[model samples]
Target: MTEKKDSPSFEETLSELDAIVSEMENGDLPLEVALGKFERGVALSRLGQQSLEQAEQKVKILVNEQGENQLHTLPENEQP
Candidate 1:
Protein backbone atom coordinates (compact mmCIF):
# COMPACT_ATOMS: atom_id res chain seq x y z
CA MET A 1 0.00 0.00 0.00
CA THR A 2 1.23 3.46 -0.80
CA GLU A 3 0.68 6.36 1.54
CA LYS A 4 -0.32 9.71 0.13
CA LYS A 5 1.72 12.75 0.99
CA ASP A 6 -0.13 15.81 2.22
CA SER A 7 0.13 19.05 0.32
CA PRO A 8 2.07 21.83 1.97
CA SER A 9 0.12 24.88 3.17
CA PHE A 10 0.53 28.28 1.54
CA GLU A 11 2.97 29.37 4.25
CA GLU A 12 4.97 26.22 3.74
CA THR A 13 5.15 26.77 0.00
CA LEU A 14 6.29 30.35 0.53
CA SER A 15 8.91 29.18 3.03
CA GLU A 16 10.19 26.55 0.62
CA LEU A 17 10.37 29.13 -2.15
CA ASP A 18 12.46 31.41 0.06
CA ALA A 19 14.85 28.56 0.87
CA ILE A 20 15.17 27.70 -2.80
CA VAL A 21 16.09 31.27 -3.65
CA SER A 22 18.68 31.35 -0.88
CA GLU A 23 20.19 28.07 -1.99
CA MET A 24 20.41 29.19 -5.61
CA GLU A 25 21.88 32.54 -4.63
CA ASN A 26 24.50 30.85 -2.45
CA GLY A 27 25.93 29.16 -5.60
CA ASP A 28 26.38 25.77 -3.97
CA LEU A 29 24.07 23.50 -5.94
CA PRO A 30 25.39 21.83 -9.08
CA LEU A 31 24.00 23.04 -12.40
CA GLU A 32 21.44 20.28 -12.81
CA VAL A 33 20.16 20.48 -9.23
CA ALA A 34 20.08 24.26 -9.37
CA LEU A 35 18.05 24.14 -12.56
CA GLY A 36 15.64 21.66 -11.00
CA LYS A 37 15.27 23.86 -7.93
CA PHE A 38 14.68 26.90 -10.10
CA GLU A 39 11.91 25.12 -11.96
CA ARG A 40 10.25 23.99 -8.74
CA GLY A 41 10.62 27.50 -7.35
CA VAL A 42 8.84 28.97 -10.33
CA ALA A 43 5.92 26.61 -9.88
CA LEU A 44 5.77 27.31 -6.17
CA SER A 45 5.89 31.06 -6.83
CA ARG A 46 2.97 30.81 -9.21
CA LEU A 47 1.00 28.80 -6.71
CA GLY A 48 1.64 31.32 -4.00
CA GLN A 49 0.69 34.19 -6.24
CA GLN A 50 -2.53 32.53 -7.26
CA SER A 51 -3.45 31.77 -3.68
CA LEU A 52 -2.85 35.40 -2.73
CA GLU A 53 -4.94 36.61 -5.65
CA GLN A 54 -7.87 34.41 -4.72
CA ALA A 55 -7.74 35.56 -1.14
CA GLU A 56 -7.57 39.18 -2.24
CA GLN A 57 -10.67 38.77 -4.33
CA LYS A 58 -12.58 37.59 -1.29
CA VAL A 59 -11.40 40.28 1.13
CA LYS A 60 -11.76 43.99 0.64
CA ILE A 61 -9.65 46.65 2.29
CA LEU A 62 -11.67 49.61 3.46
CA VAL A 63 -10.27 53.05 2.83
CA ASN A 64 -10.95 56.23 4.79
CA GLU A 65 -12.46 58.72 2.39
CA GLN A 66 -14.27 61.86 3.51
CA GLY A 67 -14.18 60.52 7.08
CA GLU A 68 -16.04 57.39 6.05
CA ASN A 69 -14.82 53.87 5.43
CA GLN A 70 -15.29 52.96 1.79
CA LEU A 71 -14.89 49.63 0.09
CA HIS A 72 -11.70 49.75 -1.90
CA THR A 73 -11.05 47.02 -4.40
CA LEU A 74 -7.42 46.14 -4.68
CA PRO A 75 -5.82 46.20 -8.09
CA GLU A 76 -6.04 42.69 -9.45
CA ASN A 77 -3.00 40.55 -8.67
CA GLU A 78 -0.96 43.56 -7.63
CA GLN A 79 1.52 42.53 -4.98
CA PRO A 80 2.08 44.83 -2.07
Candidate 2:
Protein backbone atom coordinates (compact mmCIF):
# COMPACT_ATOMS: atom_id res chain seq x y z
CA MET A 1 0.00 0.00 0.00
CA THR A 2 1.13 3.56 -0.67
CA GLU A 3 1.90 5.88 2.16
CA LYS A 4 -0.89 8.26 3.16
CA LYS A 5 1.36 10.92 4.62
CA ASP A 6 2.21 12.26 1.14
CA SER A 7 -0.63 10.82 -0.86
CA PRO A 8 -0.62 11.99 -4.48
CA SER A 9 -3.57 12.64 -6.77
CA PHE A 10 -4.45 10.25 -9.60
CA GLU A 11 -2.81 12.43 -12.27
CA GLU A 12 0.35 12.87 -10.25
CA THR A 13 0.60 9.17 -9.58
CA LEU A 14 0.15 8.46 -13.28
CA SER A 15 2.85 10.94 -14.24
CA GLU A 16 5.24 9.44 -11.73
CA LEU A 17 4.47 5.97 -13.01
CA ASP A 18 5.20 7.08 -16.56
CA ALA A 19 8.55 8.49 -15.49
CA ILE A 20 9.45 5.29 -13.68
CA VAL A 21 8.52 3.24 -16.73
CA SER A 22 10.65 5.42 -18.98
CA GLU A 23 13.55 5.16 -16.58
CA MET A 24 13.21 1.41 -16.39
CA GLU A 25 13.13 1.18 -20.16
CA ASN A 26 16.43 3.07 -20.31
CA GLY A 27 17.99 0.16 -18.33
CA ASP A 28 19.93 2.54 -16.10
CA LEU A 29 18.59 1.56 -12.71
CA PRO A 30 19.96 -1.53 -10.99
CA LEU A 31 17.85 -4.70 -10.94
CA GLU A 32 16.70 -4.10 -7.35
CA VAL A 33 15.81 -0.47 -8.02
CA ALA A 34 13.97 -1.38 -11.20
CA LEU A 35 11.97 -3.99 -9.32
CA GLY A 36 11.06 -1.46 -6.65
CA LYS A 37 9.97 1.05 -9.27
CA PHE A 38 7.87 -1.64 -10.93
CA GLU A 39 6.10 -2.33 -7.66
CA ARG A 40 5.37 1.35 -7.10
CA GLY A 41 4.12 1.70 -10.67
CA VAL A 42 1.76 -1.23 -10.17
CA ALA A 43 0.36 0.29 -7.02
CA LEU A 44 -0.09 3.65 -8.75
CA SER A 45 -1.84 1.97 -11.67
CA ARG A 46 -4.24 0.23 -9.33
CA LEU A 47 -5.01 3.49 -7.57
CA GLY A 48 -5.74 5.17 -10.92
CA GLN A 49 -7.98 2.27 -11.95
CA GLN A 50 -9.88 2.53 -8.68
CA SER A 51 -10.39 6.25 -9.15
CA LEU A 52 -11.73 5.71 -12.66
CA GLU A 53 -14.10 2.98 -11.47
CA GLN A 54 -15.48 5.18 -8.71
CA ALA A 55 -16.08 7.99 -11.18
CA GLU A 56 -17.80 5.63 -13.61
CA GLN A 57 -20.12 4.32 -10.89
CA LYS A 58 -21.19 7.88 -10.12
CA VAL A 59 -22.28 8.51 -13.74
CA LYS A 60 -25.96 8.09 -14.48
CA ILE A 61 -26.67 6.01 -17.56
CA LEU A 62 -28.79 7.77 -20.12
CA VAL A 63 -32.34 6.53 -20.56
CA ASN A 64 -34.70 6.66 -23.50
CA GLU A 65 -37.87 8.54 -22.63
CA GLN A 66 -40.46 9.35 -25.29
CA GLY A 67 -37.98 8.21 -27.96
CA GLU A 68 -35.46 10.73 -26.72
CA ASN A 69 -32.39 9.87 -24.71
CA GLN A 70 -32.14 11.88 -21.53
CA LEU A 71 -29.36 11.97 -18.97
CA HIS A 72 -30.28 11.71 -15.32
CA THR A 73 -28.64 13.67 -12.53
CA LEU A 74 -26.42 11.94 -10.05
CA PRO A 75 -28.12 10.63 -6.93
CA GLU A 76 -27.58 12.61 -3.79
CA ASN A 77 -25.80 10.64 -1.12
CA GLU A 78 -26.88 10.80 2.52
CA GLN A 79 -24.58 12.99 4.51
CA PRO A 80 -23.08 11.80 7.72
Candidate 3:
Protein backbone atom coordinates (compact mmCIF):
# COMPACT_ATOMS: atom_id res chain seq x y z
CA MET A 1 0.00 0.00 0.00
CA THR A 2 1.12 3.56 -0.61
CA GLU A 3 2.43 5.44 2.39
CA LYS A 4 -0.12 7.64 4.09
CA LYS A 5 0.49 11.35 4.47
CA ASP A 6 1.75 12.82 7.71
CA SER A 7 -0.52 13.05 10.76
CA PRO A 8 -3.94 14.59 10.40
CA SER A 9 -4.49 18.33 10.81
CA PHE A 10 -5.31 19.65 14.29
CA GLU A 11 -9.01 19.96 13.60
CA GLU A 12 -9.13 16.50 12.06
CA THR A 13 -7.21 15.02 14.95
CA LEU A 14 -9.57 16.61 17.46
CA SER A 15 -12.58 15.26 15.60
CA GLU A 16 -11.09 11.78 15.64
CA LEU A 17 -10.42 12.12 19.37
CA ASP A 18 -14.03 13.07 20.00
CA ALA A 19 -15.22 10.07 18.04
CA ILE A 20 -12.95 7.78 19.97
CA VAL A 21 -14.27 9.09 23.26
CA SER A 22 -17.85 8.58 22.17
CA GLU A 23 -17.08 5.05 21.03
CA MET A 24 -15.41 4.22 24.33
CA GLU A 25 -18.28 5.66 26.31
CA ASN A 26 -20.83 3.58 24.40
CA GLY A 27 -19.25 0.44 25.88
CA ASP A 28 -19.67 -1.74 22.85
CA LEU A 29 -16.14 -2.40 21.69
CA PRO A 30 -14.27 -5.58 22.62
CA LEU A 31 -11.39 -5.20 25.06
CA GLU A 32 -8.77 -5.36 22.31
CA VAL A 33 -10.62 -2.93 20.08
CA ALA A 34 -11.16 -0.53 22.97
CA LEU A 35 -7.49 -0.63 23.83
CA GLY A 36 -6.53 0.06 20.24
CA LYS A 37 -8.89 2.96 20.05
CA PHE A 38 -7.59 4.36 23.29
CA GLU A 39 -4.02 4.16 22.02
CA ARG A 40 -4.93 5.92 18.80
CA GLY A 41 -6.73 8.59 20.80
CA VAL A 42 -3.61 9.22 22.82
CA ALA A 43 -1.54 9.64 19.68
CA LEU A 44 -4.04 12.06 18.23
CA SER A 45 -4.02 14.06 21.44
CA ARG A 46 -0.26 14.42 21.24
CA LEU A 47 -0.41 15.53 17.63
CA GLY A 48 -2.99 18.17 18.46
CA GLN A 49 -0.94 19.47 21.34
CA GLN A 50 2.20 19.67 19.24
CA SER A 51 0.40 21.55 16.49
CA LEU A 52 -0.93 24.08 18.99
CA GLU A 53 2.51 24.54 20.50
CA GLN A 54 4.12 25.15 17.10
CA ALA A 55 1.45 27.69 16.21
CA GLU A 56 1.97 29.42 19.54
CA GLN A 57 5.67 29.72 18.91
CA LYS A 58 5.02 31.46 15.62
CA VAL A 59 2.66 33.99 17.19
CA LYS A 60 3.64 37.65 17.69
CA ILE A 61 2.21 40.48 19.75
CA LEU A 62 2.46 44.07 18.58
CA VAL A 63 1.25 47.57 19.42
CA ASN A 64 -0.32 49.51 16.59
CA GLU A 65 0.58 53.15 15.84
CA GLN A 66 -2.58 54.16 17.70
CA GLY A 67 -1.09 52.70 20.88
CA GLU A 68 -3.55 49.82 20.88
CA ASN A 69 -2.26 46.40 21.74
CA GLN A 70 -2.50 43.93 18.85
CA LEU A 71 -1.80 40.28 18.61
CA HIS A 72 0.64 39.05 16.01
CA THR A 73 2.31 35.67 16.27
CA LEU A 74 1.82 33.90 19.61
CA PRO A 75 4.65 32.82 21.86
CA GLU A 76 4.97 29.10 22.51
CA ASN A 77 4.63 29.56 26.28
CA GLU A 78 2.12 32.42 26.25
CA GLN A 79 -1.46 32.50 25.07
CA PRO A 80 -2.54 35.09 22.50
Candidate 4:
Protein backbone atom coordinates (compact mmCIF):
# COMPACT_ATOMS: atom_id res chain seq x y z
CA MET A 1 0.00 0.00 0.00
CA THR A 2 1.17 3.56 -0.54
CA GLU A 3 2.27 5.51 2.52
CA LYS A 4 -0.12 8.17 3.71
CA LYS A 5 0.82 11.78 3.22
CA ASP A 6 1.22 14.22 6.12
CA SER A 7 -0.76 16.86 4.30
CA PRO A 8 -4.56 17.13 4.45
CA SER A 9 -6.56 15.12 1.95
CA PHE A 10 -8.23 16.91 -0.95
CA GLU A 11 -11.64 16.59 0.71
CA GLU A 12 -10.42 18.08 3.94
CA THR A 13 -8.76 20.93 2.11
CA LEU A 14 -12.05 21.64 0.34
CA SER A 15 -13.95 21.56 3.61
CA GLU A 16 -11.58 24.09 5.12
CA LEU A 17 -11.89 26.25 2.04
CA ASP A 18 -15.69 26.13 2.32
CA ALA A 19 -15.53 27.14 5.96
CA ILE A 20 -13.32 30.07 5.06
CA VAL A 21 -15.77 31.16 2.42
CA SER A 22 -18.66 30.99 4.83
CA GLU A 23 -16.77 33.04 7.37
CA MET A 24 -15.73 35.64 4.84
CA GLU A 25 -19.22 35.91 3.45
CA ASN A 26 -20.58 36.76 6.88
CA GLY A 27 -18.62 40.02 6.73
CA ASP A 28 -17.54 39.92 10.36
CA LEU A 29 -13.78 39.47 10.23
CA PRO A 30 -11.29 42.32 10.49
CA LEU A 31 -9.56 43.27 7.27
CA GLU A 32 -6.22 41.68 8.16
CA VAL A 33 -7.82 38.45 9.33
CA ALA A 34 -10.07 38.21 6.28
CA LEU A 35 -7.08 38.82 4.03
CA GLY A 36 -5.22 35.96 5.69
CA LYS A 37 -8.18 33.65 5.24
CA PHE A 38 -8.52 34.70 1.60
CA GLU A 39 -4.91 33.81 0.94
CA ARG A 40 -5.33 30.43 2.58
CA GLY A 41 -8.46 29.78 0.52
CA VAL A 42 -6.59 30.61 -2.69
CA ALA A 43 -3.82 28.19 -1.78
CA LEU A 44 -6.34 25.49 -0.97
CA SER A 45 -8.11 26.09 -4.30
CA ARG A 46 -4.84 25.62 -6.18
CA LEU A 47 -4.07 22.47 -4.25
CA GLY A 48 -7.52 21.05 -5.01
CA GLN A 49 -7.15 21.90 -8.70
CA GLN A 50 -3.77 20.18 -8.85
CA SER A 51 -5.11 17.09 -7.15
CA LEU A 52 -8.00 16.93 -9.65
CA GLU A 53 -5.62 17.30 -12.59
CA GLN A 54 -3.43 14.52 -11.30
CA ALA A 55 -6.43 12.26 -10.86
CA GLU A 56 -7.62 13.06 -14.36
CA GLN A 57 -4.23 12.25 -15.81
CA LYS A 58 -4.05 8.97 -13.97
CA VAL A 59 -7.41 7.75 -15.27
CA LYS A 60 -6.88 8.74 -18.89
CA ILE A 61 -7.60 6.12 -21.56
CA LEU A 62 -6.71 6.48 -25.21
CA VAL A 63 -8.90 5.21 -28.05
CA ASN A 64 -7.62 5.27 -31.60
CA GLU A 65 -9.67 5.42 -34.79
CA GLN A 66 -9.70 1.61 -34.85
CA GLY A 67 -11.65 1.68 -31.53
CA GLU A 68 -9.02 -0.15 -29.53
CA ASN A 69 -8.60 1.03 -25.94
CA GLN A 70 -5.15 1.59 -24.51
CA LEU A 71 -4.45 1.74 -20.79
CA HIS A 72 -1.23 3.41 -19.73
CA THR A 73 0.42 5.47 -17.08
CA LEU A 74 1.28 9.06 -17.70
CA PRO A 75 4.61 9.57 -19.46
CA GLU A 76 7.67 9.55 -17.18
CA ASN A 77 7.91 13.34 -17.27
CA GLU A 78 4.28 13.66 -16.11
CA GLN A 79 4.53 11.30 -13.16
CA PRO A 80 4.41 12.91 -9.77
Best by TM-score: 4
Tens-place lDDT per residue, model 3, 26-65, is 9999999999999999999998898887775445222344
lDDT of each: 0.79, 0.77, 0.81, 0.83
Q: Which pairs of residues collide in model 3?
A: 59-73, 59-74, 60-72, 60-73, 60-74
Error of 1 at 78 (Å): 16
Estimate the overall C-alpha local distance difference test score of candidate 3: 0.81
Ranking by TM-score: 4, 3, 1, 2
Using lDDT, rank the candidates from best to worst.
4, 3, 1, 2
lDDT of the structure predicted as candidate 4: 0.83
Over 18-66, each residue of candidate 4 has an lDDT whose tens digit, in order, gives 9999999999999999999999999999989988877765555333444
Regions more than 4 Å wrong, model 3: 1-5, 60-80
Clashing pairs in 2: none
The TM-score obtained by model 4 is 0.70
Q: Which stretches of candidate 1 lie over 4 Å from their true place?
A: 1-5, 60-70, 73-80
Q: Could you tell me the C-alpha RMSD of candidate 1 in Å?
A: 8.1
- Give residue 49's error in model 4 in angstroms: 0.2
Comparing 1 and 3 on TM-score, the stronger one: 3
